[model samples]
Target: MTLKRYNMEKILKIITGLAGALFALIGLGWVIKPAAIAAEMGLPLLEGTALNTQIGDMGAFFFAGGVITLLGVLTGKRQWYYAAALLIGTAGVFRVLAFTVQGATLPIDKLIVEIVVLGILLASAKLTSVPQ
Candidate 1:
């Protein structure tokens, strides 16, 4: 059998880096046009000053998380990777909390998306610790 070599750390590094990039892009979208983005995500785009305020607040949160994740990607630190995972996992946790409080009114689709994101972030963080 021919020998095959796999540089797992290198592959995971790239994958996590790309994940950070995606988060940054998504944050930018929400920041620039939260209404349109939220609508596309199947959330109602509310109106009024409160709507703008809420969207801005949430957009800033996303932007901060995304930037931090990108920094983790650049630094190649295991702590940074876990930090990113924590950021994402918190989102999923909050979604579940909202679902519990709001009952069936909570959107099913968004819950699904949050779960997927949490899974990816957790998996990435776990893989980052693989022995070299």
Candidate 2:
């Protein structure tokens, strides 16, 4: 590969790694203390057995994603980008579907952010993908 192409691939891996780390960080927050995070987001801080079961599920999901993606980047395995794409892109798609089903319950800004993340993730996946 050309030096420029190699550099681009490295940059892409780093970006993906960073994104995964942030995702894990947020998930950690959700895992560590869902009540505080939920309150900050103006969500109901439900307190009960059922709440406990549900609260950490998202945290675990993102945390696993982050760990996997970071490991892939560190190992120079470009394939993990596909996992990140699937996780993030699917989330964005589901968000849009929710809007369609629920009629725009989330704020426009939130939707925009999700869409942007999805776009960037997809572009990054495309940029970094190669036949290995």
Candidate 3:
């Protein structure tokens, strides 16, 4: 059987969709066991602090966004995908900013990975054409 070549747009959409699903899984894991995540990341366990609360909220948002992104991908809804991509990309930027503002250095590896994912999503958003 011959392999079919994919255009950049299709590849980007697949990448973004997969990344969104992965993010959703991560978020679900965090929601289920925030303490486990904290321990794994060497962060303090949730003790009802403002920072922890913020983290929780962020996690929830990410989870919801991821779900929406996945649905958009499945439905082939260009607008939904674009909106989700923008929202998640903006959130990723804010996360990096938050890390910097806390007198902590940004984790380059994490930031880079997030940036790549966002880039793929953005490219996919632009590449997708609405069905007539």
TM-scores of the models, in the order given: 0.73, 0.76, 0.73
**Cα miss at 104, model 3 (Å)?**
2.5
What's the true lDDT of residue 114 in model 1? 60
lDDT-superior candidate, 2 or 3: 3
For 2-121, candidate 3 gives per-residue lDDT tens digits of 233246656766877887787787677677877776575556765667656746775776687788778667766677676776777786687677887776666677667767766776
Q: Candidate 3, TM-score vs. the true structure?
A: 0.73
Better of 2 and 3 by TM-score: 2
lDDT of each: 0.66, 0.68, 0.69
Which pairs clash in model 2? none
**Distance from true position, residue 47, model 2, in Å?**
1.6
Clashes by residue pair, model 1: none
Better candidate by lDDT, 1 or 3: 3
Record all residue pairs in model 3 with backbone atoms less than 3 Å apart, i.e. clashing.
none
18-80 per-residue lDDT for model 2 (tens digits): 877877876797878787867765678666876776576767767876776676566554566
Off by more than 4 A, model 3 = 1-6, 40-42, 49-55, 99-102
For model 2, where is the 10-residue window of minimal lDDT? Answer: 123-132
